[model samples]
Target chain A: MPADVTALELAGLRKSYGGQAAVREVDLRLPRGALLTLLGPSGCGKSTLLRMIAGFVEPSGGDIRINGRSVLALRPERRPTAMVFQSYALFPHMTVFDNVAFGLRLRATPRVEIADKVRRALALVRMDAFEARFPSELSGGQQQRVALARCLVVEPEILLLDEPFGALDRHLREEMQVEMRKLQRQLGVTMVVVTHDQEEALVLSDYIAVMRAGAIEQFAEPIELFDRPTNRFVASFMGVSNLVDGIVERDGEVSFRFPGGARLPVVSDLPAGPATLALRPEAVRLCAPDDAACRLTGTVAFTSLVGSRMSCEIKVGETVVTALVPRHGSGPAIGERVGMALAAEQLQLFAR
Target chain B: MRGGAMPLLMLPMAVLMALFFGAFAVFGFVSFLQPASGMPGYQGPLGLSNYLRFLTDPAALAILGETIVFAIVVTLASILLGYPLAYIMARSPYRVVRSLLLGALVLTFLSGSINRAYGWLILLGRRGVVNDALLALGLVDRPVALVYNWTGVFIALLHFTLPYFALTVFGSIRSVPVQVEEAARDLGAGPLSTFFRITVPITVPAIISGAALVFSLAISAFAFPLLLGGGRVRLISNYIYDQLFVAFNLPFAAASSTIFLVVAIATLCAFFWLEGAVTRRRAAKRGAA
Candidate 1:
């Protein structure tokens, strides 16, 4: 394969069941040795798209090319892609070694070479010592590791996983997410992971494709997606809690006019009338009501502890904007009047 | 609720067990006695003469051997035909197909054995529907004898046993997750390979159980042999019936029944043992690999 050829390319990929679309016009191109994540909520078609790539699902209209060659006509057994199911569908009768060796045995690899490859694969997942145990005897996380080894041992052109850590507890899920990222980098295998957890996607993916309603909402790096989401849905999905609907009037200098007669200067090329401003919770700061830089004034309506920070919901007229501030000495009391400061560069404006 | 009521709850089961075993015990005791001449019951003198006659008589031993061999063949044939029926019943995507297969099996099960045997007679007789078709098609110059022989008995016994085997394995096949089989395919195993290596091995316990049930049913059959055998395909059950009714030899019949019971129990035990060994060997095979 040429160096310029992409590892996986999907163009206009779509699937519909009974005339109802499950996946619609999906297009993506992933270079070799990169990890991409399809991040979305349940029923958002992320898993459906991954299954299409692995040849388990047939596309109603689209092209799926592995290494720049169309693989639409191949069967699942003939495809070069492997999938780790959400349920970690390991054969319960087979031991870990045999489970990982299943693909090699099917390919008619020599006995000695199969043993070597299986051992190496097990060692990669840190499960070499438990190779002789059945899947029923292993814990959830251990079975997940074995599932990964089973896919990796075959050296698939692209590895796909559907909600791989959905079964693990919170603590173990985080640990495995980081470990999976490390292993992916170590092997430098092109991989696509589907997850509903944004944090897991951020921790593992080199590029994230945020999806909603069977369409890609945004595709960018984690920092880029978090810092600058293009739409309100993407903003909300990326954990931006404060969205203020207002009007923009460009009188010599552009400024956003709030509902309660509050005005704040903003930088935007959008010739706007009605618009929405997405502000990160951490970007809003609380200060004395009479502070010189105070752009919006409100009374503290609610306060709650969030780890090392205090989250306050400030009521400005009928709209409530949340601000996350460092917890210092119980923070601001409820009913206290406060002024909210907004960061200029952090403001993302979207035409409503 | 406590220990006080436990024995009372068990009293009905105890009574049932006593009645069942009490009859067998009486038969066993009678097997050791002497048959009274010109009577229907046994006499007082105790001896092993009945067992010795059954063990040493070549003609009687041949019937026993033939019955055992026939049962084994019927059981194997049932599994070969029934597993595919079960797989289709559990896995067909069409609701109408699954329902039709289940309905057919249940209908076969609900019908009386003698009814099914007579139905087979009408289908497989010399001038029956099958032979008529063959003659009309010019495949056979004359009507072929398909009844009143071993073939008739075999066909009737298979019809009687197929439902038991298929229904027994149907639930087990359904319980094997579809994703597990898909995983095998995703790992490069073709559909047939996946079925044989994954689906079949996973359902081995159910297959063994189904085979055991039909094996017992086939070995102890009486009605089909009597109705279809026409006195030529006499099995052990018919032979024992003749010994008791025709010859009025109660002691010898009791002895034969005792021997049959022991053999059937041993065969079932061996089937269960094979199932256990298969599962255990699967686990132990990991070390060697």
Candidate 2:
């Protein structure tokens, strides 16, 4: 695949609205054929950053490169990129055929070619039979499919989506997520999807860029991001994380000491100093008193019988921590004394 | 839903309609009675001679032609001029400015025709400010004749009808959400392409309605045409006026008035038919989709 050369590069992108910085000095790169997601909360700069790349928004300062060529000054159409809007801005007046063929028609492509390409794009999105339907006549998921078809038919070097499935119901959203990942992989198109949903990011991205207040906090593969988030922000934003205040002792081991005189030994190369220890809720286990590890003794604050798992909230001092246990297992009852132990390798220690 | 209100609401309006209809029926019957040549009152047998004369009159034919042509021209002019303005109004960034523009449009139509034409007369007449400016700028050697002609009539008609077209078009354009435009552009379309292919097509209903409104307004206009067209241009209304006032032929004039009324009513029916066609086509397209 020639290692799929860097398809897009953003160097210090910046944007502000009404003196409020929406995005600031953000930099990232996407490899060819890679599906990268900008994941963060609502107020985060994920969508703004995506807009800058899509040319709907101009960066206050920075350069955008595609295929090692500068494209910062290019208009949206001039640049070889297409965007799927969160609202699925399909042309309500146009038939599905025309909407999908819009870009080719703009380029003055031949009629027969446009028809062929539109059909192919529609097939890719599994909407081949809906070519004559207007956007308003379609369901939400169908509109989203047509939107995808429209962008795909353009055959752009990079495809961008801004929370494209945010309007879909949960089941449709999950289905579209799977459909999108499959289509992107099948076409080997370099794609960027902006989403606030962490699970959507996890499921759809090969690489996830966790954004925070106008900046890229961490960029890595999904597993890399989940396993080793460089900062507390990425770790906490990505999933349910239990953060413990701790101090690094000698060697590679660390100990988290709470106000209640409970000490937990953890694994980290972080130098001897005050730190915050983060571990995924799934990484901690409910253990018997004889089981040895970094244990925290607390009363079960709450318990929820989720479909496949029993989620128990354990209280350590005044801080409430959650642990997910297998559904059939015997778990601690609410208000019962319990001891939770963190696996050594699962603990993430960040220098405070 | 209110107490003792249903009958009260219907009674006053029903009485008024009955009175109005009764007067129309009486006058219309009187118009049909033949007049005696030597007598001071109607004495001849009831006949259709007056109606026959009205239908065959050359002057009536000319007035009808003038009315139709005037209506078509003004409607076309309004549509051509109002569309861009409406588009701009719809897309205006400032709500205050948009509201002010709409308010100005309302102001144009609120005043009587006599007032509006008088204002135009001062601006468009020879030796008026516009002509003075043109003369001073050396654009013309003499003051151009602008008032009391077809050109002046057209100007007044356009001014009256333009605001109507603008408001209707504005409503249509504003109803089309911006996301549709953004979607088109995001699909790799340039701004111009997005507008013509998407935004313009979506607002076709507005354009149709605006044209219809301007046409209806232009056809019935009496005050402006009478004031600005002078005697040289005799529309149906002016012809009817001349028959009743100058000719003093009440039967002939009433017959002519009835003919004109029928024609106006017919034209309005045709306009509605055309709207029906457009709406039906739109509905069919939506159903097909």
All candidates' lDDT scores? 0.92, 0.82
Q: Report chain B TM per candidate.
A: 0.97, 0.86
Residue B271 in model 1: lDDT: 99
RMSD of 1: 1.9
CAPRI-style quality class for the chain A–B interface of candidate 1 = medium
Model 2 DockQ reads 0.52
In model 2, which regions exceed 4 Å deviation? Answer: A245-253, A271-274, A327-330, B1-31, B35-46, B94-100, B245-250, B279-289
* Each prediction's RMSD to truth: 1.9, 3.2
Evaluated against the true structure, the overall lDDT of model 2 is: 0.82
lDDT of 1 by residue, A1-352 (tens): 1335589999999999999999999898888888899999899999999988888889999999999899999999999999899999999888899899999999999999999999999999999999899999999999999999999999999999989999999999999999999999889888999999888988998889999988999999899998999989889888898999988889999998877867778999879699998999899888888998788888899999999999999888767889999988989999999998777879999999
Q: CA lDDT of A317 in candidate 2?
A: 78
TM-score versus the correct structure, for each prediction: 0.96, 0.91
Model number with the top DockQ: 1
> Residue A301 in candidate 1 has what lDDT?
95
